[model samples]
Target chain A: MTTEPRLVEVRKNVLKQNDIIARALRDRFREAGVLAVSFVSSPGSGKTAFLEKTLTLLHSRYRVAALVGDLATENDAARLGRSQVPVKQILTGTVCHLDAAMVQNALDGWDLTQLDFLFIENVGNLVCPSSYDLGEDLRFVLLSVTEGEDKPLKYPTIFNSADVAVITKSDLAAAVEFDEAAVLRNIQAVRPGMEVLKISAKTGEGLAEYLEYLERRCSSSRAGAAASN
Target chain B: MHELSIAMSIVEMAQEESERCGQAQVLAVHLRLGQLSGVVKEALLSSYEMACEATPLEGSQLLIEEVPVEVFCPKCDGPRALGSIQWFCCPECGTPTPEVLHGKELEVVALEIEE
Candidate 1:
């Protein structure tokens, strides 16, 4: 005998697995007193160069490391390894974005306590990375001047998901005639009150301010952990 | 692009639920997809069937409910429907709100199963 079809309520989140893992990672980061920063952007947004500069700048004074994700090849990881810090390459092999599980796996066996700052550079893709949270304390969405001022508007979900917006390749701003005000307006439209920073790793234009801001955030997180302990 | 993986997750979840219900055949799966979730509905629709292949969910219908982005406007003091995905301002009073009230949902709300 055939039975009738009935609707049953599930009300379950599709990303529940990833979310749980991300929460655990967040807690681990907090307990370990480390500031985790993740970067997302389209291909050729200068995320690697920016991260390389950041890691190099912080390597002398602090314990820092990086995990860079890519579809294939360890080219980025090799480039970042030149910073003389620990670097891991996550080859996704076809996965468009890095999820919490990949991050948790990449960080396995590492002592989070020894690290002052951990940087995760996501597989370069604006669309897919927005959906999966990698459990980073801060998500920086990078936008180069050559990519156009409307990049934020074109990819609003990513802008909304990110904590900060970095306009990279400022050294080519005039060559590309990048309109800073227009990009600012676009970012404000998608994510109101998002912290935006313009930096050019090539010439060390805004790295000092960005580095100081990062150090401040790291110190605050460490202080928070201390107070709690 | 990642919808295939997402679809696979949905199928896995539904399969487990179906098994819990004495291995009932899932006739249809109801999903709530939000605009701000960064998932394209059409992409998911195409990927759903592929994900269900060789599984109990094969040939089952995937019903999707699109959820629009809503933000809590400070000036309005209420939830406002976002005018556009790119614009987070209230369509009514034009107040910009950083607080997102909803539209991030990607959930399996219900399942139609044949007993």
Candidate 2:
């Protein structure tokens, strides 16, 4: 009799492994009382500019660190490092998006407990970044007014996945004839009742509100974790 | 392209499954892809060959089954297929529905391998 090998049916998501690691990282961040925030946006949307300004503003009050991802180049990390906050650059090589594996690798040798906030600046792409969860407590999606107000309608998936939407480069709004009402309406249409913040890294307008929002979210999550524990 | 990375994951998973079953080679991988999954099928197919090389899934074929977006119509109280991602209106009653029943799926459902 010919022996037949038994077929084992295994229906598991390839991303499940990454999810597990991400969940663990989230728990670790919670325990360490670190507010981990991530950013996703298209190329040239002023992510690095906003991040540099944010780091400079928050550096005095809280310990902040950042990890920047790109297909190639440490330029972003180098620029953000000028703010004098610890920064790491993740080179994804041929990969178009930043996965949890890359984040874990980048965080190696760093003490999570030392920092009050960790910002992960994802690779500048609106599409692929939404699929990977990097265990951040908050996700900020940036859209510059110069890009157009209908960006939310064009990239619903990214907007749907993000917790907060930030309209960057608001200083150029008047010059670019940016329609604020239309952008807000489009954002609400895609993600109903989502929080939207308008800011200009150059002028520092509305940066205070954004920081307060971050502080509120961080504290709320901390309270929730404490209650659960 | 992101397709190459996705293809690599598929190949790795297929290889692991083949080893578990003591299979000599993987013949095909069955995938269910939704129209709104944000994955370009043509790009994925092109990258699959390159990603699968030097792996157990080498020469394996990807069998993609397209899944249409199904939404629940509030006006009609019935399920309807979405023609496009932009338009979420019901074809029967022309009422807009935001509740999605099925779509945005990218999964490998089954594997055909030779023992």
Indicate which candidate wins on TM-score.
Answer: 1
Q: Weakest 10 consecutive residues, lDDT, candidate 2 chain B?
A: B82-91
**lDDT, candidate 2, A59-165, per-residue tens:** 99999999999988989988998999999999988777888888888999999989889999999999888778899998999999999989998987787678899
State how far residue A113 of model 1 sits from its true place (Å). 0.2
The candidate that wins on DockQ is: 1
Q: Evaluate model 2: give its lDDT.
A: 0.85
Over the full model, what C-alpha lDDT does candidate 1 score relative to the true structure? 0.94
For model 1, the docking class works out as high
**Which regions in candidate 2 have their CA more than 4 angstroms from the true location?**
A1-8, B68-84, B87-102
* TM-score of the first chain of model 1: 0.98
Q: Write out the backbone clash pairs for model 2.
A: none
